[model samples]
Target: MSARLYVGLMSGTSMDGIDCALARCDERGTTLLATYEHPIPPATKQRIVEISRPGDNEIERMGALDRELGHLFAKATLSLLSKEQVPSTEICAIGSHGQTIRHHPPSSHQPSEQGFTLQIGDPNTIAQSTGITTVADFRRRDIAVGGEGAPLAPAFHAAAFAKAGHTRAIVNIGGIANVSLLHSEGQVLGFDTGPGNTLLDHWINRQLGQAYDKDGQWSAAGSIRPDLLARLLEHDYLSQSGPRSTGKEVFNLAWLDECLADLSSPATPQEVQSTLAEFSAESIARGIAQCEVPVSEVYVCGGGARNSDLMRRLAAKLGTATLETTASLGIEPEWVEAAAFAWLAWRSMAQLAGNIPAVTGAQEEVILGGIYPGARPRTQ
Candidate 1:
């Protein structure tokens, strides 16, 4: 059977850029076809960061940014197809993960009868601009049915990487870190580990005006501040022992400033950067350790896999189970999330369920994402 083509667009919490991936999806599995990276305009990124936190006129700011992002995502999809010399008509659909602004899952600490998670990048605009069906708004349905509605990637990860007789942990360190514990016995477990690159990226931008620390060199150069690391590690979220999810709403610059407020001595920029890396590494390691099955090997993905210093720290914290990029398993670290979204789009189009209840703590598995049909071809 000929494989169907699909496009996946993802703009993670880092707010760096949009990742557009082309994949050939079928019953056998999904195969990545082509990929493109479109930088998010600095102004647009700043606007997104601003509205992520509590602010006045949120409706206005968010409404505008959503349409802006939709145009960008459409441009990214068209750009990818043009570069590959392919026609948009050939693509089955576009899976747009959109930009997540706030995600508040129902929990004992913060109970909500009407829990909601919002991601915006107008799928209508995407469909109109690209003339291709778009699948988006993927998380809220799971949330509506009494689930975390975040960390939806684990279900895709489990499907892509699990192998019989071996247990593997897929750790994706985006703005926030999450791990998929894949067991040979077909049990899949996952949750957010807290604070990946968001703190590091914010600190560097504040102190050095750089988007992010290159290879985590600045962080590696400084010594870890024991007190700061301990305090950050003690965050209440880290102590929780069940399904969880978080985003910029809970781990932004404001949260970091609050953590530093009680410190006896203010830490230098470099020290704080180092502590952030250590904190992320420790939180990831701790999450992996808590899995019901011992992971014999841990595969890293997302932008974090490219940070050498962070990888070194992760290795030191893991201490034995091989730590390597997802490339070892035939998937490049950077493209895994985008590819997963492509697969999700395939699932959506096939009318198959996408969310995994075991991973998201949902009452049942459900098909995620709302579909917007492509426009009809022009007549002669």
Candidate 2:
């Protein structure tokens, strides 16, 4: 089959915005054609964060937010197509990762509960509104099959960013961080590391009302409270092996408060921010250190890559491995996650499998997502 165009939409754990990427894919490979981003309104963002944790009147609020996000996602898709002057009929499908609100993957803490994940922007709404096919709710099937149903992007990373004779690790630092280790011989390994920008963003937002630390300048100004950092790192999830995943459920503000309560002396906001930054960096580096295959280079993607303080801490912890943004590998850091979704969409349209069992610990590889057919086919 000849190459076909596809759009991928992702609203990650950050809850900051929707990222849409247009790309071409076929048997050869996928190519990112153009990209666009739509920021989430503050009200919408607040609603997302609020419901991400337990709260009352959740069903009513959640139902409303789900539809609201679906509309936002469709708007993002249409805006991208408009910017590129591409007709709706020209795109084969849209792979939407949606917004993750609750991710209770099976673990020691929640072993009794069945694993489940909820990513809300309704694909039906997206398809109906955009007049384009949409594939979403990509994680649940994997969960059903006893997989973490996450770190799915590693499969795409192995396909798109792997090197021939060296082991490379791709670290995606969104609200949560995950690492993909691509071996020289083509074996792919991946798992969620720990906190990425979720804590830092939450800390900064709660402390200063800023969306983020702005390259981690505020964090850079503060001293890393050894006590706080040590307490934060002691979380059991950080020590778990691969085939694992995590989210705000375990590392949100409530969790942070519990740790802070343990600190004998109160910490300044900057100090706490610094410690959170260090926590992210340390957790990431620890994950890398556990790689069975030594990694020669580390490429970081997602919002955390832009945090200078986090980057410096990672570099120091890494010691010898070359640390660079995914841009070094021809894909900009900011767009990697977005592009991965695009690739997943392409895989789905091709009736190909999108998840790597090795990474997510699924019993077998599975073609992910539920497809909502588009209203129009590409114009002949």
Candidate 3:
């Protein structure tokens, strides 16, 4: 049988860039063919952050961003193909997760109502620009079936990391942190642990004008002020159970300011950043302990994994040896999310159910993603 190829594109909460991955997948499994990261233009990034929580002009700006991002995503794919020498026609489809603006999980008052989630990207434009069939909007169906419609990485994590006898937790420390706990008994549990680098990133950027902590060097140079850490953890979301989700809506710069106000001594901005990193490590460790299943090891991924201070804090708090990344297990950390969309697209094409009912709380298994055919001829 010939190899089947698909391109996967992901723009995570970090608002860092567009990650594109080409994969060869078959009945056996999937393998990464080529991967590239296309940074979001500074202006575009600022626009996205502004519209994340929009006003009356939201509709107009959202439409514009969708088209803009679609073209950027297509460009990323084309660039990858050129660098890898792969013909576009060789790929079966392009799976784009788009950009998530909002995620509202089902609540007690609205038990009967399905949760709502939104991702904006013009799939039609992506197809037209790349000449490859595109599959996008992979979250609504799970939400419609009563799921939280997020932390969707667990299904893919299970496929990539689930072991027969060992229990493990895959922690993705993006702008937000989420964990997928896979057990020997075949039980998989996942949810947003809380703020990861989001709060720290915003605080540092505001205080130091740096986009990120840069291996958490500044954070390492400072101390974790206990009082500030206590205040930051007071939010109710920290105590929330699994199947819960959160984003910038609940944990943004404003939230940080409120927490900061409760502090008596004004520590240096670097110290505050250190405290925030500790907050992330503590929250993640606490969340993992709450899981019913035992986790023998923690595999860290996403941009956060590269931060030495963050990883050191995480290992110390969790009392587990930190593993390198999914790459060590044959899948690169950067490509994990992108590869997931590729898997989702393949499942959609096969008409197979993708979402895990237990993880998402969906009423039942459902096939995720909507397909957009390219203008070119379809291959049999």
Cα RMSD, model 2: 1.9
Best-to-worst lDDT order: 2, 1, 3
Compute the lDDT for candidate 3. 0.84
- Looking at candidate 2, the ten consecutive residues that score lowest on lDDT are 371-380
Q: How would you encode candidate 3's per-residue C-alpha lDDT over 1-380 as one tens digit per residue? A: 14489888999878888988888766668788788988899998887887787577888899999899888888888888878888788888888999888776674227566557888878999899888999999989888887888878898888878888978888988989998888878899888889999988898889889889999999989988989988888889988776777788888888888888877878788888999999999988887887676577788878898889998888887765455667677886767888888887888877888888777778898989899997673222
| RMSD versus native structure for model 3 | 2.3
lDDT of 1 by residue, 213-291 (tens): 9899999999999989888977888998768888777777888898888799999999999999999999999999987
Better of 1 and 3 by lDDT: 1
Task: In angstroms, give how far residue 325 of model 1 lies from its true place.
Answer: 0.3
How many angstroms is residue 207 displaced in model 1 relative to the true structure, after the best TM-score fit?
A: 0.8
For all candidates, what are the clash counts?
0, 2, 0
User: Over 4 Å off in model 3, which ranges?
Assistant: 1-3, 108-114, 320-322, 377-380
- Quantify all predictions' global Cα lDDT against the true fold: 0.88, 0.89, 0.84
> For each candidate, C-alpha RMSD in Å?
1.8, 1.9, 2.3
Compose the digit string of candidate 2's lDDT tens values, residues 227-282.
Answer: 99999989988877878999888888989999999999999999999999999999
| Whole-structure CA lDDT of model 2 | 0.89
